[model samples]
Target: MYLPSFTLDEKLAVITGATKGIGRAIGRAIALAFAVAGADVVLISRTESDLSKVKSEVESFGSKAYTICSDIKDYAYIINELDRLIGARPIHIWVNNAGINIRSEALNVTEAEWSEIIDVNMKCSFFLAQAAAKRMKESGTGKIINVSSVGGHVALRTGVVYAMTKSAIIQMTKNLALEWGKYGINVNAIGPWYFPTALTEELLKDDQYVQEILYRTSLKRIGKLEELAGTAVFLASDASNYITGQTLFVDGGMTIYGF
Candidate 1:
């Protein structure tokens, strides 16, 4: 056949921060996409209620849905519980979509803020990926997707710590891809510019800020969740079987423009 298949049939996937903002959007989109492709999902979030809501939505697609209500920052607890929770099911895909950002000037950042952001964004991501890789190694095949940000590539006024972690993630993707390629694993990252999420809803309300953002973006519009989800699906499917160690920016041309 000339065309490659994007089907995720008979596979199982896991998504962290499966309940809010970008995480929720990507998680749900992936779950729905996987369902349509004939795969099941494991949704991870801090709130049981939110997990249940997404679980119901995923089940509507006629695929199995498992919910894990726990903090992603608690990587040890999560790594330990995953085996029990998943039982004999092998994870075919894992999305590190849980992230937090505190917008602040470099001069105003505090140690507590730095530590919290690092713990959640960087530390947990590494350990969790390590855990997921271990399970994926058994099957000798899997996809690991990291949710990075454009700030990781270009400097932004958002927060220095956040950028540092994202940059680390991009590098981490490359290193992991190199180390795991021999075992048939792929590691990649997605860097988004602006998407309408609870975190950015208020920020977008500022007309001047929106215009400033639009000025830098070639598309001159914020991204849709499905657009980002579509990218995730590509990376997760057989379409991306040969791709790894790359950060696909869903930034609407923001990275290429000059201020």
Candidate 2:
């Protein structure tokens, strides 16, 4: 029996915001995927306690694991800490999933709220991608998978700032792919919609929220965290070596539907 070669064997992966939500789910799933394919993983987040628990999960998959605690919003911190970790070890895959969303309308948005949203989702993402691309370029190859949102490709009831940030991600992804494709670094994004996770856990349970989401989602249902794992594994592995500068929407076909 021949197994699919879609594994990330002998590779090293660095996952950001790995303590909770889509980040946590991705961390656990990617660790298992990489281990099954034979690779080691490094988990990053702000809490050592949370990191410990997550590390245990990854280790339970029978693969090696490392932990890093860094506030993604800290530019110097992100660069210094990540640089140290990747020292000597070649980074084969990078998942830029650390992010936050503010619920203020464009009119009510304060300077702080806007900065916080942009700092993590846009700024941190860009710099981390730059760092990873450097290491990848040295080897002439790597994968940068950014976790965007359905809000990114389409303006939802979310807010103007978030929508703007996400759309920026799609464009950033394309731009990175265009510039780095010749260098062998594939830049891509995954836009998730209505997933039941930490970030959306509160929002999903709201009756009004669910109604609005389902109305536009066409499928009339929210997404599951597990459902998104497969797509992440694909984009992070050799299976997607040829795919780049595109975003795969894991929405219930929401981006295409309109009232």
Candidate 3:
């Protein structure tokens, strides 16, 4: 009998921003996928109730699920909580999916908004990855998947700070992979374009905004959350063991399309 290498059996995956939108979908999908493949999951979010709900959903997949309520911007709190929950448990995968953005032009972006966005999207992710990597280093193997955005690669008319932080994520992925490859830790990133997540809900409601997005996208439609989940699973599983230090863009060709 031959089994596929894609199975995550016996592995443990941790995902942040597990409450809503792309993060929620990725959390659920990864939990179920890993469960089906015989692995357990840990979900983290800002809301305990929502985390509990996702916990129930993941547990229904016949895999153990642990939930943590955390504000990603609070680095110390998150790291401490993670250490407490992960005590002596080998974490095979860590997904840094928590992020925030403010729709403001370059000149109009406030210091508070800029600070918040950077703290959540970049600073938190790096610190969290640092914490996870410490454990992974001990085990000599792990996967870290950062949820970046196509905005990181191209200039967007949206929030300039958001794009800046995302761009940093891409670089961070590369650097981490380069540094951690010796310890068998693979660091990578996923860049998604227009998706129907809560973050994009308001903009998607605008017909003109939607049309403008589709105009540059070869698929001419927004991405589905499951698609992003699939990519996350691939990165988390052994299927992508040979891959690292790369950003897989799930943008429906939007990044490559030229006006």
Candidate 4:
């Protein structure tokens, strides 16, 4: 009775971008983790084949996983489909993990690139959170986890637009948590530095870039997928019940470096 329970038993979770990179890792990890913890998961992604793969993995863990193959940018349809799929089940966890990056220099950033990143990263995330919040309010308890980045905290040379959206998410997480705390909704974010995901696969291949990354990271190594996923699980579980409106940086000390 003295120990706090971190079990997600009987809870339901929805994870966007559940097919690749950080999203896939987090989604699959969460799905499996949640399954072991006794929760059902809803995986949202754009590819049916990939969704099926993750679905199989989740089912292997003996938990039900429902897959939705749709672009998160089309959040309206996604939300509607979600309602139809779940049918009155209160969502206990919602992870906005779908995102894209155009990794261009500031001056070379095109309007199309800017719009695309903003739409998927910022716009889609907000509306989805809004729709999720409405449903969560009905149940009086829920957790909303936004997948932000270390780029949001410190300046990154990746691209201006991508950083802008991430920074905005951090702010959004705070404001939403403040507004929704009364309704028993906890809004939070996770910022990662470098992980071996498809998103960073190309960059990590560059020795110089890897060296630069290691120089900044106190841990001096790229993060493991499970490490990042563990952070998400903590935020989603009852362990973080009293925590909200904060971005947990899983950056291995990258944000703390200054010279």
lDDT for 1 in candidate 4 is 55
* Residue pairs with clashing backbones, model 4: none
Task: Show the lowest summed lDDT stretch of 10 residues, model 3.
Answer: 21-30
What are the models' TM-scores?
Answer: 0.96, 0.92, 0.94, 0.97
Residue pairs in clash, model 2: none
The sequence of per-residue lDDT tens digits that candidate 2 reaches over residues 12-120 is 8888888765576655665556666667788888888888987887777777788888787765776677667667788888888888877787779999888888888
Lowest-sum lDDT 10-residue window in model 1:
21-30
Cα deviation at 146, candidate 4, in Å, is 0.2
Q: Score residue 90 of candidate 3 by CA lDDT.
A: 92
lDDT of 2 at 80: 71
Tell me how far the alpha carbon of residue 104 in candidate 2 is from the true structure, in angstroms, after superposition: 0.9
RMSD of each: 1.3, 2.3, 1.9, 1.2
Off by over 4 Å in 2: 1-4, 26-32
TM-score for candidate 2, residues paired by index: 0.92
Q: CA lDDT of each candidate?
A: 0.88, 0.82, 0.86, 0.89
How many clashes does the backbone of model 3 have?
0
lDDT by residue (tens digit), candidate 1, 106-206 = 99999999998899889888888988899899999999999999989999976999999999999999999999999899999999998887678899999
Cα misplacement distance, residue 26 of candidate 3 (Å): 4.2
Minimal lDDT window, size 10, model 2: 21-30
